[model samples]
Target: MPNQAYLRVAGLSKRFGSGENAVAAIENLSFTLDEGRFLSILGPSGCGKSTLFNIIAGLMAPDSGDVTLNGESMLLRPGMTGYMLQKDLLLPWRTVADNIILSQTLHGVRRSKALDAALPDARACGLETMLRRRPDELSGGQRQRAALVRTLQTGKPLLLLDEPFGALDAITRLHLQELLTDVCMKKDKTVLFITHDVDEALLLSDEVLIMGSQPGRIIAHYHLPQEKPRTLKTLALPRLIEIKGEIMQLLDQEVKRHDPHA
Candidate 1:
Protein backbone atom coordinates (compact mmCIF):
# COMPACT_ATOMS: atom_id res chain seq x y z
CA MET A 1 0.00 0.00 0.00
CA PRO A 2 2.82 2.41 0.97
CA ASN A 3 5.19 3.30 -1.83
CA GLN A 4 7.56 0.36 -2.07
CA ALA A 5 10.73 1.18 -0.24
CA TYR A 6 13.80 1.65 -2.36
CA LEU A 7 16.07 1.15 0.64
CA ARG A 8 15.29 -0.70 3.86
CA VAL A 9 16.95 -1.52 7.13
CA ALA A 10 15.48 -4.27 9.24
CA GLY A 11 16.13 -5.41 12.84
CA LEU A 12 19.54 -3.73 12.91
CA SER A 13 21.63 -4.06 16.05
CA LYS A 14 25.23 -3.21 16.86
CA ARG A 15 27.39 -3.38 19.95
CA PHE A 16 30.97 -2.66 20.95
CA GLY A 17 33.34 -4.18 23.55
CA SER A 18 32.67 -7.19 25.75
CA GLY A 19 30.79 -8.18 28.92
CA GLU A 20 30.90 -5.37 31.48
CA ASN A 21 32.32 -2.92 29.02
CA ALA A 22 29.83 -3.85 26.30
CA VAL A 23 27.94 -0.92 24.87
CA ALA A 24 24.98 -1.25 22.61
CA ALA A 25 25.19 1.47 19.96
CA ILE A 26 22.07 0.52 18.08
CA GLU A 27 19.31 -1.84 19.03
CA ASN A 28 16.53 -3.25 16.91
CA LEU A 29 16.35 -0.14 14.78
CA SER A 30 14.59 -0.20 11.46
CA PHE A 31 13.20 2.19 8.86
CA THR A 32 12.54 2.56 5.16
CA LEU A 33 13.25 5.32 2.67
CA ASP A 34 11.01 5.48 -0.32
CA GLU A 35 12.30 6.04 -3.83
CA GLY A 36 13.31 9.65 -4.55
CA ARG A 37 12.52 10.68 -1.00
CA PHE A 38 14.58 12.88 1.29
CA LEU A 39 14.75 11.66 4.92
CA SER A 40 16.52 13.48 7.74
CA ILE A 41 17.55 12.00 11.11
CA LEU A 42 17.92 14.10 14.25
CA GLY A 43 18.97 13.18 17.78
CA PRO A 44 21.00 14.16 20.82
CA SER A 45 24.78 13.80 20.65
CA GLY A 46 26.09 10.20 20.85
CA CYS A 47 22.81 8.80 19.55
CA GLY A 48 24.46 6.45 17.01
CA LYS A 49 23.45 8.57 14.01
CA SER A 50 26.84 8.12 12.34
CA THR A 51 26.81 4.45 13.28
CA LEU A 52 23.54 4.05 11.43
CA PHE A 53 25.03 5.87 8.44
CA ASN A 54 28.06 3.60 8.46
CA ILE A 55 25.87 0.52 8.56
CA ILE A 56 23.74 1.76 5.69
CA ALA A 57 26.78 2.84 3.69
CA GLY A 58 28.19 -0.69 4.13
CA LEU A 59 31.36 0.64 5.71
CA MET A 60 30.61 -1.41 8.82
CA ALA A 61 28.66 -4.56 9.51
CA PRO A 62 25.90 -4.63 12.07
CA ASP A 63 26.02 -7.24 14.78
CA SER A 64 22.58 -8.22 13.52
CA GLY A 65 20.22 -7.27 10.71
CA ASP A 66 20.72 -6.33 7.06
CA VAL A 67 20.60 -3.39 4.73
CA THR A 68 18.82 -3.96 1.48
CA LEU A 69 18.45 -1.97 -1.70
CA ASN A 70 15.76 -3.03 -4.12
CA GLY A 71 15.42 -6.21 -2.05
CA GLU A 72 19.11 -7.09 -2.42
CA SER A 73 21.36 -7.39 0.59
CA MET A 74 24.04 -4.69 0.87
CA LEU A 75 26.10 -6.00 3.76
CA LEU A 76 29.76 -5.72 4.63
CA ARG A 77 30.61 -3.94 1.41
CA PRO A 78 31.49 -0.36 0.60
CA GLY A 79 30.39 1.75 -2.38
CA MET A 80 26.80 0.57 -2.33
CA THR A 81 25.69 4.19 -1.93
CA GLY A 82 27.16 7.64 -2.36
CA TYR A 83 28.37 8.93 1.03
CA MET A 84 29.33 12.48 1.98
CA LEU A 85 30.76 12.73 5.48
CA GLN A 86 31.13 15.58 7.96
CA LYS A 87 34.53 16.41 6.53
CA ASP A 88 35.01 16.86 2.80
CA LEU A 89 37.83 14.25 2.96
CA LEU A 90 39.22 15.52 -0.33
CA LEU A 91 42.75 14.59 -1.24
CA PRO A 92 44.96 17.66 -1.16
CA TRP A 93 47.21 16.26 -3.88
CA ARG A 94 44.40 15.85 -6.37
CA THR A 95 42.94 18.70 -8.42
CA VAL A 96 39.27 19.53 -8.05
CA ALA A 97 38.35 17.75 -11.28
CA ASP A 98 40.41 14.71 -10.42
CA ASN A 99 38.85 14.45 -6.97
CA ILE A 100 35.37 14.80 -8.40
CA ILE A 101 35.98 11.83 -10.68
CA LEU A 102 37.78 9.69 -8.12
CA SER A 103 34.83 7.36 -7.59
CA GLN A 104 34.39 6.86 -11.32
CA THR A 105 38.06 5.96 -11.70
CA LEU A 106 37.86 3.54 -8.78
CA HIS A 107 34.84 1.88 -10.37
CA GLY A 108 36.93 1.33 -13.51
CA VAL A 109 35.29 4.09 -15.53
CA ARG A 110 37.67 5.51 -18.11
CA ARG A 111 39.31 8.79 -17.16
CA SER A 112 37.87 10.59 -20.17
CA LYS A 113 34.34 9.34 -19.52
CA ALA A 114 34.60 10.12 -15.83
CA LEU A 115 35.73 13.64 -16.53
CA ASP A 116 32.92 14.11 -19.02
CA ALA A 117 30.36 13.03 -16.43
CA ALA A 118 31.84 15.05 -13.57
CA LEU A 119 32.43 18.29 -15.47
CA PRO A 120 28.80 19.28 -15.54
CA ASP A 121 28.37 18.52 -11.84
CA ALA A 122 31.46 20.53 -11.02
CA ARG A 123 30.10 23.43 -13.01
CA ALA A 124 26.70 23.03 -11.40
CA CYS A 125 28.28 23.34 -7.96
CA GLY A 126 30.24 26.45 -9.06
CA LEU A 127 33.58 24.63 -9.22
CA GLU A 128 34.12 25.08 -12.97
CA THR A 129 36.85 27.72 -12.72
CA MET A 130 38.69 25.84 -9.97
CA LEU A 131 38.73 22.47 -11.65
CA ARG A 132 42.47 22.41 -12.02
CA ARG A 133 43.18 23.74 -8.56
CA ARG A 134 44.20 21.40 -5.73
CA PRO A 135 42.00 20.90 -2.67
CA ASP A 136 44.29 23.09 -0.59
CA GLU A 137 43.61 25.99 -2.90
CA LEU A 138 39.83 25.81 -2.51
CA SER A 139 37.76 27.34 0.26
CA GLY A 140 35.90 25.13 2.76
CA GLY A 141 32.60 25.43 0.91
CA GLN A 142 34.32 24.82 -2.43
CA ARG A 143 35.99 21.70 -1.10
CA GLN A 144 32.64 20.40 0.18
CA ARG A 145 31.03 21.11 -3.18
CA ALA A 146 33.74 19.13 -4.92
CA ALA A 147 33.18 16.30 -2.45
CA LEU A 148 29.45 16.31 -3.15
CA VAL A 149 30.10 16.34 -6.90
CA ARG A 150 32.40 13.36 -6.44
CA THR A 151 29.77 11.46 -4.45
CA LEU A 152 27.05 12.14 -7.00
CA GLN A 153 29.40 11.13 -9.81
CA THR A 154 29.22 7.56 -8.48
CA GLY A 155 25.70 7.34 -9.90
CA LYS A 156 24.44 5.48 -6.86
CA PRO A 157 20.67 5.44 -6.43
CA LEU A 158 20.94 6.13 -2.71
CA LEU A 159 22.84 9.02 -1.10
CA LEU A 160 24.00 9.04 2.54
CA LEU A 161 24.89 12.49 3.87
CA ASP A 162 26.27 12.77 7.45
CA GLU A 163 26.22 16.43 8.31
CA PRO A 164 28.11 17.41 5.18
CA PHE A 165 27.73 21.10 5.96
CA GLY A 166 28.39 20.90 9.71
CA ALA A 167 31.91 22.31 9.44
CA LEU A 168 31.12 25.36 7.34
CA ASP A 169 30.11 28.85 8.44
CA ALA A 170 26.40 29.55 8.81
CA ILE A 171 26.11 31.43 5.52
CA THR A 172 28.01 28.80 3.59
CA ARG A 173 26.01 26.03 5.27
CA LEU A 174 22.73 27.61 4.11
CA HIS A 175 24.07 28.08 0.59
CA LEU A 176 25.20 24.46 0.32
CA GLN A 177 21.94 23.20 1.81
CA GLU A 178 20.00 25.02 -0.89
CA LEU A 179 22.40 23.80 -3.54
CA LEU A 180 22.11 20.22 -2.30
CA THR A 181 18.32 20.39 -2.27
CA ASP A 182 18.25 21.78 -5.82
CA VAL A 183 20.67 19.18 -7.16
CA CYS A 184 18.91 16.24 -5.49
CA MET A 185 15.50 17.43 -6.65
CA LYS A 186 16.73 17.84 -10.21
CA LYS A 187 18.19 14.34 -10.17
CA ASP A 188 15.30 12.82 -8.22
CA LYS A 189 17.81 11.30 -5.84
CA THR A 190 16.90 9.43 -2.66
CA VAL A 191 18.78 10.79 0.33
CA LEU A 192 19.29 9.90 4.01
CA PHE A 193 20.65 12.92 5.86
CA ILE A 194 21.90 12.99 9.46
CA THR A 195 22.20 16.25 11.33
CA HIS A 196 22.14 17.80 14.81
CA ASP A 197 20.57 21.03 13.57
CA VAL A 198 16.78 21.01 13.89
CA ASP A 199 16.43 23.86 11.39
CA GLU A 200 18.50 22.03 8.80
CA ALA A 201 16.41 18.88 9.11
CA LEU A 202 13.12 20.80 8.95
CA LEU A 203 14.26 22.81 5.95
CA LEU A 204 15.46 19.92 3.79
CA SER A 205 13.61 16.78 4.78
CA ASP A 206 10.45 15.27 3.35
CA GLU A 207 10.24 13.50 6.69
CA VAL A 208 12.24 13.82 9.88
CA LEU A 209 13.05 10.91 12.24
CA ILE A 210 13.95 11.68 15.81
CA MET A 211 16.13 9.26 17.79
CA GLY A 212 16.90 8.73 21.45
CA SER A 213 20.29 7.88 22.96
CA GLN A 214 21.66 4.91 24.99
CA PRO A 215 20.92 2.31 22.37
CA GLY A 216 19.59 4.58 19.71
CA ARG A 217 16.05 4.07 18.44
CA ILE A 218 13.47 6.11 16.61
CA ILE A 219 11.41 8.10 19.10
CA ALA A 220 9.22 10.06 16.73
CA HIS A 221 8.58 10.64 13.06
CA TYR A 222 7.27 13.79 11.42
CA HIS A 223 6.11 13.89 7.82
CA LEU A 224 6.60 17.35 6.33
CA PRO A 225 4.56 18.87 3.53
CA GLN A 226 6.40 18.59 0.23
CA GLU A 227 4.02 20.74 -1.83
CA LYS A 228 6.31 23.76 -1.55
CA PRO A 229 10.02 24.07 -2.12
CA ARG A 230 11.87 24.20 1.23
CA THR A 231 13.80 27.35 1.95
CA LEU A 232 14.83 29.65 4.84
CA LYS A 233 11.27 30.98 4.85
CA THR A 234 10.02 27.44 5.52
CA LEU A 235 11.65 27.67 8.94
CA ALA A 236 9.28 30.50 9.88
CA LEU A 237 6.12 28.65 8.88
CA PRO A 238 3.80 27.98 11.84
CA ARG A 239 3.72 24.25 11.20
CA LEU A 240 7.49 23.99 11.04
CA ILE A 241 7.86 26.09 14.18
CA GLU A 242 5.44 23.84 16.06
CA ILE A 243 7.23 20.69 14.95
CA LYS A 244 10.60 22.21 15.79
CA GLY A 245 9.45 22.95 19.32
CA GLU A 246 8.19 19.42 19.71
CA ILE A 247 11.46 17.88 18.56
CA MET A 248 13.47 20.25 20.75
CA GLN A 249 11.48 19.24 23.79
CA LEU A 250 12.02 15.57 23.05
CA LEU A 251 15.74 16.12 22.56
CA ASP A 252 15.96 18.12 25.79
CA GLN A 253 14.26 15.34 27.68
CA GLU A 254 16.75 12.86 26.21
CA VAL A 255 19.66 14.98 27.43
CA LYS A 256 18.25 15.22 30.90
CA ARG A 257 17.66 11.49 31.12
CA HIS A 258 21.33 10.84 30.42
CA ASP A 259 22.66 13.48 32.78
CA PRO A 260 23.48 12.19 36.26
CA HIS A 261 22.92 15.55 37.92
CA ALA A 262 19.59 16.18 36.21
Candidate 2:
Protein backbone atom coordinates (compact mmCIF):
# COMPACT_ATOMS: atom_id res chain seq x y z
CA MET A 1 0.00 0.00 0.00
CA PRO A 2 2.96 2.32 0.44
CA ASN A 3 4.68 4.12 -2.44
CA GLN A 4 7.97 2.25 -2.07
CA ALA A 5 7.30 -1.35 -1.25
CA TYR A 6 10.34 -3.47 -0.50
CA LEU A 7 9.67 -5.68 -3.52
CA ARG A 8 7.16 -4.83 -6.19
CA VAL A 9 6.13 -6.56 -9.42
CA ALA A 10 4.00 -4.53 -11.73
CA GLY A 11 2.09 -5.72 -14.84
CA LEU A 12 4.17 -8.87 -15.10
CA SER A 13 3.49 -11.01 -18.14
CA LYS A 14 5.48 -13.86 -19.61
CA ARG A 15 4.69 -16.14 -22.47
CA PHE A 16 6.35 -18.98 -24.31
CA GLY A 17 6.58 -19.75 -28.03
CA SER A 18 4.66 -17.73 -30.56
CA GLY A 19 1.17 -17.29 -31.95
CA GLU A 20 -0.52 -20.69 -32.39
CA ASN A 21 1.96 -22.53 -30.24
CA ALA A 22 2.13 -19.80 -27.64
CA VAL A 23 1.41 -20.44 -23.99
CA ALA A 24 0.83 -17.82 -21.37
CA ALA A 25 2.92 -18.38 -18.28
CA ILE A 26 1.77 -15.37 -16.31
CA GLU A 27 -0.51 -12.56 -17.31
CA ASN A 28 -0.53 -9.13 -15.80
CA LEU A 29 0.64 -10.62 -12.49
CA SER A 30 1.41 -8.07 -9.85
CA PHE A 31 2.21 -8.17 -6.14
CA THR A 32 4.14 -6.27 -3.48
CA LEU A 33 6.09 -7.73 -0.60
CA ASP A 34 6.98 -5.66 2.44
CA GLU A 35 10.39 -5.80 4.04
CA GLY A 36 11.03 -8.80 6.31
CA ARG A 37 7.69 -10.40 5.47
CA PHE A 38 7.50 -14.07 4.63
CA LEU A 39 5.10 -14.73 1.77
CA SER A 40 4.21 -18.03 0.13
CA ILE A 41 2.54 -18.58 -3.21
CA LEU A 42 0.19 -21.58 -3.63
CA GLY A 43 -0.75 -22.67 -7.10
CA PRO A 44 -1.29 -25.73 -9.24
CA SER A 45 1.49 -26.98 -11.51
CA GLY A 46 2.18 -24.95 -14.69
CA CYS A 47 0.78 -21.84 -13.04
CA GLY A 48 4.04 -19.91 -13.76
CA LYS A 49 5.30 -19.92 -10.18
CA SER A 50 8.80 -20.89 -11.24
CA THR A 51 8.63 -18.58 -14.21
CA LEU A 52 7.80 -15.70 -11.96
CA PHE A 53 10.62 -16.65 -9.62
CA ASN A 54 13.07 -16.84 -12.50
CA ILE A 55 12.12 -13.36 -13.55
CA ILE A 56 12.42 -12.06 -10.02
CA ALA A 57 15.82 -13.69 -9.59
CA GLY A 58 16.95 -12.18 -12.89
CA LEU A 59 17.44 -15.62 -14.37
CA MET A 60 14.91 -14.84 -17.06
CA ALA A 61 13.32 -11.69 -18.34
CA PRO A 62 9.58 -11.31 -18.56
CA ASP A 63 7.94 -10.37 -21.81
CA SER A 64 6.44 -7.36 -20.06
CA GLY A 65 6.70 -6.17 -16.48
CA ASP A 66 8.96 -4.50 -14.02
CA VAL A 67 10.51 -5.91 -10.86
CA THR A 68 11.71 -3.44 -8.26
CA LEU A 69 13.54 -3.90 -4.99
CA ASN A 70 13.70 -0.94 -2.66
CA GLY A 71 12.58 1.43 -5.44
CA GLU A 72 15.44 0.29 -7.68
CA SER A 73 14.57 -1.63 -10.84
CA MET A 74 16.02 -5.15 -10.82
CA LEU A 75 15.50 -5.83 -14.50
CA LEU A 76 19.05 -6.68 -15.48
CA ARG A 77 20.57 -7.42 -12.13
CA PRO A 78 21.31 -11.05 -11.32
CA GLY A 79 22.60 -12.22 -7.97
CA MET A 80 21.01 -9.24 -6.25
CA THR A 81 18.94 -11.69 -4.18
CA GLY A 82 19.36 -15.19 -2.87
CA TYR A 83 17.70 -17.90 -4.95
CA MET A 84 17.42 -21.54 -3.91
CA LEU A 85 15.81 -24.44 -5.67
CA GLN A 86 14.35 -27.75 -4.54
CA LYS A 87 17.62 -29.42 -5.49
CA ASP A 88 20.52 -28.63 -3.20
CA LEU A 89 22.77 -28.15 -6.26
CA LEU A 90 25.87 -28.37 -4.16
CA LEU A 91 29.09 -29.22 -5.90
CA PRO A 92 29.88 -32.93 -5.57
CA TRP A 93 33.54 -32.39 -4.73
CA ARG A 94 33.11 -29.55 -2.26
CA THR A 95 32.85 -30.18 1.45
CA VAL A 96 29.63 -29.11 3.15
CA ALA A 97 31.40 -26.17 4.75
CA ASP A 98 32.92 -25.22 1.43
CA ASN A 99 29.59 -25.50 -0.35
CA ILE A 100 27.85 -23.35 2.22
CA ILE A 101 30.32 -20.58 1.66
CA LEU A 102 30.46 -20.86 -2.14
CA SER A 103 28.33 -17.80 -2.76
CA GLN A 104 30.43 -15.61 -0.54
CA THR A 105 33.56 -17.13 -1.98
CA LEU A 106 32.50 -16.10 -5.48
CA HIS A 107 31.67 -12.65 -4.22
CA GLY A 108 35.32 -12.12 -3.17
CA VAL A 109 34.83 -12.88 0.52
CA ARG A 110 37.64 -14.84 2.11
CA ARG A 111 36.80 -18.49 2.77
CA SER A 112 37.90 -18.31 6.40
CA LYS A 113 35.79 -15.26 7.03
CA ALA A 114 32.77 -16.79 5.31
CA LEU A 115 33.16 -19.95 7.34
CA ASP A 116 33.38 -17.89 10.53
CA ALA A 117 30.23 -15.99 9.59
CA ALA A 118 28.33 -19.11 8.60
CA LEU A 119 29.27 -21.13 11.67
CA PRO A 120 26.33 -20.06 13.75
CA ASP A 121 23.84 -20.77 10.96
CA ALA A 122 25.47 -24.12 10.25
CA ARG A 123 25.10 -25.09 13.89
CA ALA A 124 21.53 -23.86 14.01
CA CYS A 125 20.70 -25.91 10.92
CA GLY A 126 22.21 -28.98 12.60
CA LEU A 127 24.96 -29.10 10.01
CA GLU A 128 27.83 -28.50 12.39
CA THR A 129 28.88 -32.13 12.37
CA MET A 130 28.31 -32.67 8.67
CA LEU A 131 30.17 -29.57 7.53
CA ARG A 132 33.32 -31.54 6.90
CA ARG A 133 31.50 -34.09 4.74
CA ARG A 134 30.60 -33.77 1.09
CA PRO A 135 27.10 -33.69 -0.33
CA ASP A 136 27.15 -37.37 -1.29
CA GLU A 137 27.99 -38.29 2.28
CA LEU A 138 24.97 -36.46 3.64
CA SER A 139 21.35 -37.47 3.73
CA GLY A 140 18.64 -35.61 1.82
CA GLY A 141 17.72 -33.47 4.82
CA GLN A 142 21.33 -32.73 5.59
CA ARG A 143 21.93 -31.67 2.04
CA GLN A 144 18.98 -29.33 2.22
CA ARG A 145 20.31 -27.95 5.46
CA ALA A 146 23.63 -27.26 3.81
CA ALA A 147 21.85 -25.62 0.92
CA LEU A 148 19.89 -23.43 3.31
CA VAL A 149 23.05 -22.28 5.01
CA ARG A 150 24.52 -21.57 1.61
CA THR A 151 21.53 -19.46 0.64
CA LEU A 152 21.68 -17.46 3.81
CA GLN A 153 25.42 -17.04 3.51
CA THR A 154 24.77 -14.99 0.42
CA GLY A 155 23.73 -12.27 2.91
CA LYS A 156 21.10 -11.00 0.55
CA PRO A 157 18.06 -9.47 2.22
CA LEU A 158 15.52 -11.00 -0.18
CA LEU A 159 15.40 -14.78 -0.58
CA LEU A 160 13.46 -16.64 -3.24
CA LEU A 161 12.99 -20.29 -2.38
CA ASP A 162 11.25 -22.77 -4.64
CA GLU A 163 10.00 -25.68 -2.53
CA PRO A 164 13.22 -25.85 -0.52
CA PHE A 165 11.78 -28.57 1.75
CA GLY A 166 9.44 -30.36 -0.64
CA ALA A 167 11.77 -33.31 -1.17
CA LEU A 168 12.49 -34.12 2.46
CA ASP A 169 10.49 -36.52 4.65
CA ALA A 170 7.57 -35.22 6.69
CA ILE A 171 9.50 -34.81 9.94
CA THR A 172 12.52 -33.35 8.18
CA ARG A 173 10.33 -30.96 6.26
CA LEU A 174 8.61 -29.78 9.42
CA HIS A 175 11.90 -29.24 11.19
CA LEU A 176 13.41 -27.36 8.29
CA GLN A 177 10.29 -25.22 7.97
CA GLU A 178 10.73 -24.07 11.55
CA LEU A 179 14.42 -23.57 11.01
CA LEU A 180 13.79 -21.47 7.94
CA THR A 181 11.26 -19.26 9.70
CA ASP A 182 13.44 -18.74 12.72
CA VAL A 183 16.56 -17.94 10.72
CA CYS A 184 14.90 -15.74 8.13
CA MET A 185 12.62 -13.87 10.51
CA LYS A 186 15.28 -13.22 13.10
CA LYS A 187 17.69 -11.96 10.44
CA ASP A 188 15.04 -9.66 8.96
CA LYS A 189 15.10 -11.36 5.56
CA THR A 190 12.22 -10.97 3.16
CA VAL A 191 11.18 -14.32 1.72
CA LEU A 192 9.00 -15.28 -1.22
CA PHE A 193 8.48 -19.01 -1.17
CA ILE A 194 6.67 -21.31 -3.56
CA THR A 195 4.93 -24.43 -2.25
CA HIS A 196 2.04 -26.62 -3.27
CA ASP A 197 1.19 -27.74 0.25
CA VAL A 198 -1.52 -25.65 1.86
CA ASP A 199 -0.37 -26.47 5.39
CA GLU A 200 3.21 -25.51 4.57
CA ALA A 201 2.03 -22.18 3.19
CA LEU A 202 -0.26 -21.57 6.14
CA LEU A 203 2.31 -22.47 8.76
CA LEU A 204 5.18 -20.49 7.27
CA SER A 205 3.80 -17.44 5.54
CA ASP A 206 2.84 -14.08 6.99
CA GLU A 207 0.61 -13.90 3.93
CA VAL A 208 -0.52 -16.49 1.39
CA LEU A 209 -1.40 -15.88 -2.24
CA ILE A 210 -3.48 -18.46 -4.10
CA MET A 211 -2.86 -18.33 -7.83
CA GLY A 212 -5.25 -19.38 -10.56
CA SER A 213 -4.13 -21.27 -13.64
CA GLN A 214 -4.56 -20.83 -17.42
CA PRO A 215 -2.99 -17.40 -17.21
CA GLY A 216 -1.45 -17.68 -13.77
CA ARG A 217 -3.25 -14.88 -11.97
CA ILE A 218 -3.76 -14.24 -8.27
CA ILE A 219 -7.32 -15.09 -7.24
CA ALA A 220 -7.06 -15.07 -3.48
CA HIS A 221 -4.86 -13.61 -0.78
CA TYR A 222 -4.93 -14.35 2.95
CA HIS A 223 -3.07 -12.33 5.56
CA LEU A 224 -2.02 -14.57 8.40
CA PRO A 225 -1.39 -13.64 12.01
CA GLN A 226 1.90 -12.27 13.33
CA GLU A 227 2.34 -15.17 15.71
CA LYS A 228 5.94 -16.34 15.98
CA PRO A 229 7.54 -19.64 16.97
CA ARG A 230 4.58 -21.37 15.32
CA THR A 231 4.71 -25.11 15.26
CA LEU A 232 2.61 -27.97 13.92
CA LYS A 233 0.30 -27.34 16.84
CA THR A 234 -0.44 -23.91 15.45
CA LEU A 235 -1.90 -25.44 12.29
CA ALA A 236 -4.59 -27.03 14.41
CA LEU A 237 -6.04 -23.67 15.43
CA PRO A 238 -9.63 -23.07 14.28
CA ARG A 239 -8.78 -19.96 12.26
CA LEU A 240 -5.97 -21.74 10.41
CA ILE A 241 -8.19 -24.75 9.84
CA GLU A 242 -10.89 -22.57 8.32
CA ILE A 243 -8.42 -20.72 6.13
CA LYS A 244 -6.92 -24.03 5.04
CA GLY A 245 -10.33 -25.24 4.00
CA GLU A 246 -10.93 -22.07 2.04
CA ILE A 247 -7.55 -22.36 0.31
CA MET A 248 -8.25 -25.97 -0.59
CA GLN A 249 -11.61 -25.11 -2.06
CA LEU A 250 -10.12 -22.29 -4.08
CA LEU A 251 -7.35 -24.55 -5.42
CA ASP A 252 -9.88 -27.22 -6.29
CA GLN A 253 -11.90 -24.67 -8.19
CA GLU A 254 -8.82 -23.56 -10.10
CA VAL A 255 -8.04 -27.15 -10.98
CA LYS A 256 -11.58 -27.80 -12.17
CA ARG A 257 -11.52 -24.63 -14.21
CA HIS A 258 -8.31 -25.62 -15.94
CA ASP A 259 -9.43 -29.22 -16.34
CA PRO A 260 -13.15 -29.68 -16.01
CA HIS A 261 -12.82 -33.44 -15.68
CA ALA A 262 -10.37 -33.08 -12.77
Model 1 lDDT tens row, 1-262? 6555788899999998999998889899999888988999999888899999999888899999988998888887888899999899998889888899999999899988999888888888999999999999989999999999999998997999999999999999999998998999899999999999999998899989999989988999889974536878768888889999999999989889999566
lDDT tens digits by residue: candidate 2, 39-154: 99999999999999999998898999999999988886899899999999999999999999999999899989999999999999999988889899999999999999999998
What are the RMSDs of all candidates, in order?
1.5, 1.3
TM-score attained by model 1 = 0.96
User: Please, what is the TM-score per model?
Assistant: 0.96, 0.97
Model 1 alpha-carbon drift over 4 Å, by segment: 1-3, 226-228, 260-262
| The candidate that achieves the highest lDDT relative to the unseen native structure | 2
Global lDDT scores for all candidate models: 0.90, 0.92
